[model samples]
Target chain A: EAGVTQFPSHSVIEKGQTVTLRCDPISGHDNLYWYRRVMGKEIKFLLHFVKESKQDESGMPNNRFLAERTGGTYSTLKVQPAELEDSGVYFCASSPIDTYGYTFGSGTRLTVV
Target chain B: GIQVEQSPPDLILQEGANSTLRCNFSDSVNNLQWFHQNPWGQLINLFYIPSGTKQNGRLSATTVATERYSLLYISSSQTTDSGVYFCAVNFNKFYFGSGTKLNVKP
Candidate 1:
């Protein structure tokens, strides 16, 4: 089976610009999540989706960031008016079952200048 | 959010050496995992060990839930093992430690 795949492996945008990163989870997976690592920081959770329903979004950084899982099949994270601090690697992962080890996508490197 | 810490922030070892990386979490967790981020920044799952011990080839990991600590052991280290190792856990949310950078000289 194909693993989790993320589009636009790398993106460069000017500050205040909008960027959307997409992720397609493994077939039949119900748990999808987004995580990111800012420079000089550990990777942190962004949000989670369970079969198209957002299970939790407490980790979302701010109002400028939006995450959506349409049809519970794929996910997109949009950052509007992104700041320099938003430049980092965004990782997407999914698990076939509840509370299982996640299979992660390669990741998207975002650079906001 | 729970706190995660990895000891000996940086380590350098010669080939054929064995090393133990430690991770300490502030609270109990429902999940714990170890991952290796290569030079290219790809996170590769090393082990999914919440409790007890598991071994795969020269890589082994042990998580002591009661003590809220986990240890990842690398045996017969090679240059290919050089990278950043992160220990992450989740209670209601996921948390990752700063990570330990290991450089194995050939």
Candidate 2:
């Protein structure tokens, strides 16, 4: 089975621009999560999706960020008007509801200059 | 929110040596996991021991849930083991420790 997959392994955009990161979780796994590591710091949770519903999104930074998991298959995180502080390696992980082990992707390194 | 702290913060060891890393959490958790982030920035799952002990090859982990602490042991360390080890705990949302950066010289 394929692991969690993230697109555009690297992305650089000007501040105030918009960037969207996509994640394709392992097949049949309903639990998907988004996390970020800023400037080699500790990784922080962004949100979690259970199938097509947002289970928990308390970690989302601000109103500029939006996340959606459609049809319970894949997820998308959009950072509108990206800020310089938003640059970091965004990781996506998935797990089976019955199990707690998470399989993470290589991560999308976003750079907002 | 929960607090997680990893010991040493950094460690340097010679090849074929053994070492221990520790993670302490502030609260009880429903899930505990260990991950190794390699140089390429891939988080590889090492163990998922919310409690009890489990071992895989040269790596082993023990999580004493009641004490809110966990330990990761690496035997016969290799250069490939040089990376950042992260301990994450989940209650409603996952929280990660600062990570222990390990450098195993060959």
Candidate 3:
């Protein structure tokens, strides 16, 4: 089975620009999660989706960040007017029915200059 | 929110050596996991050991829920084992510690 897959692998954008990172989870998985890691920091959870519903989003830093799971298969995380601090690696993971283990994507390294 | 702390923030070991990493959490958790983040930033799930012991090859993990702590052991370490190991706890939400950075010099 294919593991979680993410698009762009890496992204570079200027300040105040908009960037979107995408994640395609493992097939037949019902739980999808978003996470981010800033430079020299630990990876942190951003949000979670159970199918098409947002299960949790408390980890989101601010309103500038938005996430969507269309049809509960692929997810998109959009950062508007990106700031320098927004640079980091964003990861997506998936599990089946609150499954204990998560299969993670390689991550997208976003660089906001 | 849960407070997760990992011991020996940085560890260096020669190839073929053995090491142990510890994680202490502040509260009870229903879900506790260990993950290894490779240099390329891929988060690989090592173990989802909420309690008890589990072994996979040279890696094994044990979580004592009553003590609010978990342990990860790497035996016969190799250069490929170099990375950041993270322990995360789910107390309503998932919280991760800064992680233990392991360097296995070949």
Candidate 4:
């Protein structure tokens, strides 16, 4: 089985630009999560999805950030008008229904200049 | 929100040496995991031990949920073991510790 996959391994954009990061979870996983880590900071949760429904999004930083899981298969995190503070690594993970352990993707390194 | 702290924020070891890293959380957690982040920024799940002990080859981890702490043991370490080890705990959402950065010299 393939591991969780994230696209655009690295992204560079100017402040106020829009950027979208994508994640493909392993087949048959029911839970998906998004996390972010700024430079010199611990990784922080962003949101979670259970199938097509958002289980929790309390960690979303602000209105500028949006996440979607379509058909409960893949997820996309979009940062509109990205800010310099948004520069960091974004990770996506998925877990099976019966397990608490998760499979994480190779993160997308975003640099907002 | 729970607080997670990792000890020995940085470590340097010689290949074939052994080392132990510690993680302490402030509250009870429903899930606890250890992950290794390679230099390329890939997080590899090492253990999903919420309690008890587990071993995989040269790496082992033990979590004492009642004590709100966990330990990761690396035996006969290799240069490939050089990376950042992170401990994450979940209450509702996951919270990660500041990782322990390990450098193993060959």
Residue pairs in collision within model 4: none
Clashing pairs in 1: none
- Chain A vs. true chain A, TM-score per candidate? 0.97, 0.98, 0.98, 0.98
Report DockQ per prediction, comma-separated: 0.69, 0.78, 0.65, 0.81
True contacts kept of each: 0.54, 0.80, 0.69, 0.83
For this target, which candidate reaches the highest lDDT against the unseen true structure? 2
Model 1, range A75-112, lDDT digits (tens) per residue?
Answer: 99999989999999899999876665878888899999
Provide the global lDDT of candidate 1 against the true structure: 0.92
TM-score of 3: 0.94
Give the per-residue lDDT of model 2 (tens digit) for B1-106: 8999999799999999999999999999999999999997888899989999999999999999999999999999999999999999988778999999999999
Candidate 3 local lDDT, A54-109, one digit each (tens): 99998899999999999988999999989999999999988888566677788999
Q: Give all TM-scores, in the order shown.
A: 0.95, 0.95, 0.94, 0.95
Q: How much is the lDDT of residue A84 in candidate 4?
A: 99
Positional deviation of A79 in candidate 1, in angstroms?
A: 1.2
List, residue by residue over A66-102, the lDDT tens digit for candidate 2.
9999999999999999999999999999998877778
Q: If chain B of candidate 4 is superposed on the true chain B, what is its TM-score?
A: 0.99
Residues B36-94, candidate 4: write the lDDT tens digits.
99888878899999999999999999999999999999999999999899999977678
